[model samples]
Target: EDLIAIINQYGGAIPETYGVPVEEIQKGIKSGVRKVNIDTDNRLAITAAIREAAVKDPKNFDPRHFLKPSIKYMKQVCLDRYQQFGTAGQASTIKQIPLDEFAAKYASGELTAVAKKAVTA
Candidate 1:
């Protein structure tokens, strides 16, 4: 496949490889590619949504009328990507402490040392 050939040639340093189909995205993920950017597809979806919304409601001059559909379309695309990445049901597995508790610990200087090491590393 073209994707495999490119990965073989460039290893992990390829730049700006966008417009990959959904099946190729899975293949890339399986091939140890950690980051996948989908900004272009999301942008296209949002643009189409806004244009459709504007045409459907020609009387509405409010930006929210267009933005609502755009946001909805973008969110759906993101949710689809999450599912494709096999990470959709991971919310319950993430250990997230309360923001107030985290802030208290941070203010008490508990995370200062950890923060410095993290930043330096």
Candidate 2:
């Protein structure tokens, strides 16, 4: 949660409108919300960057020069996603949490799970 708070405070990936504010998201991050799913934003970023590059250099012949900025833009998008998920510079933190342990716990029904769960009940 503390990490989430930090990311949110830094204006990272999390959207601003919700019942639970940025503080809550931060708390959730602190409470072991490790994986944040993001796809659409990435797609948009890549598409927009490519379109911009194309518009800027419509008849350019050199693939390397033309694609370089697009690649950089995509990298920035990924970095932004990392910031939003509180996973930037998280290599050491990940090493601390053993994947095997998480898998065992999940298998033993000791871990709760939800992926955008919805209910009509």
Candidate 3:
């Protein structure tokens, strides 16, 4: 709603749209969805920020004036998604593999992909 409001306030047009509900996404996570791609959400947030900045300051030609808010908005989206997806604070769990060991494994073909079980779809 905020996105649509801002876009309309800036005289831009987008058809009214809806996305998967947050509750549904949370359910997906509970059902073993490890990752959810959300670039569209990020883009919408960024575009809203840019449109708002441009509309609020029409005479301001400085790009930084527009970009700073977009960066802030984007960061908020990323942080929100991380928290929602339960990925926040989980980066610390990744064990750091040494570069030499990683390279040796790659050279020995130990990094080869394991075939997946075929899906009916």
Candidate 4:
């Protein structure tokens, strides 16, 4: 999954050698990616926003006013990405998986035990 995220972040246009591979990150979004990390984008957006703000108002002393638009823009970008990634309707699917059940299975190292056992047996 970490590799997938790294690939999604920097893997520029799919190579012809791969013969038209499906974008796994996009597929993951469709299945479910509850916590999508946007550190780089967030940092870049905020930095750009701050630089612009500072340039426009060199002596801007009010932190709240200076950063308000930046925060709003960052949030809007995050929302747009979430929608584009097909995660907008994830809540419904997420609700189907009970948290307790998921946690228990996860803790027991049996999240996919049944399938594994069936295959190995």
Q: Please give, for residues 1-121, the per-residue lDDT of candidate 4 as tens digits.
A: 1222323344323222222222665665555433556666665556556655666678887887558866966786678667766666677675576889989979988865332222221
Give per-residue CA lDDT, model 2, range 6-120, as digits (tens): 3344444544333444456566677666555445544444455555556567787676754676567667767876776567897776456588997998999888765653332
After TM-score superposition, the amount by which residue 102's alpha carbon in candidate 3 deviates from its true location, in angstroms, is 4.5
Candidate lDDT values, in order:
0.70, 0.58, 0.83, 0.57
Error of 2 at 86 (Å): 2.5
Candidate 3, run of 10 with poorest lDDT = 112-121
Q: Whose lDDT is greatest here?
A: 3
Q: How accurate is candidate 3 locally (lDDT)?
A: 0.83
- In candidate 3, what are the lDDT values of residues 1-121, reduced to their tens digit? 4666777778778877889877899887777666698888888887898899998899999999989988888888889888887788888899999999999999999999776544432
Residue 16 error, candidate 3, Å: 1.7
Model 2 residue runs over 4 Å out of place are: 1-28, 61-66, 96-121
Model 1, TM vs. native: 0.60
Higher-scoring candidate on TM-score, 1 or 3: 3
lDDT preference between candidates 1 and 3, better one:
3
lDDT of 3 at 67: 90
Q: Where is model 4 more than 4 Å wrong at Cα?
A: 1-24, 28-35, 89-121
Q: After aligning candidate 1 to the native by TM-score, how far in Å is the CA of 36 from where it should be?
A: 0.9
Pairs in clash, predicted candidate 1: none
> How big is the positional error of residue 63 in model 3, measured in Å on the Cα after superposition?
1.8
Off by over 4 Å in 3: 98-121
Colliding residue pairs in candidate 2: 1-26, 1-29, 1-30, 5-26
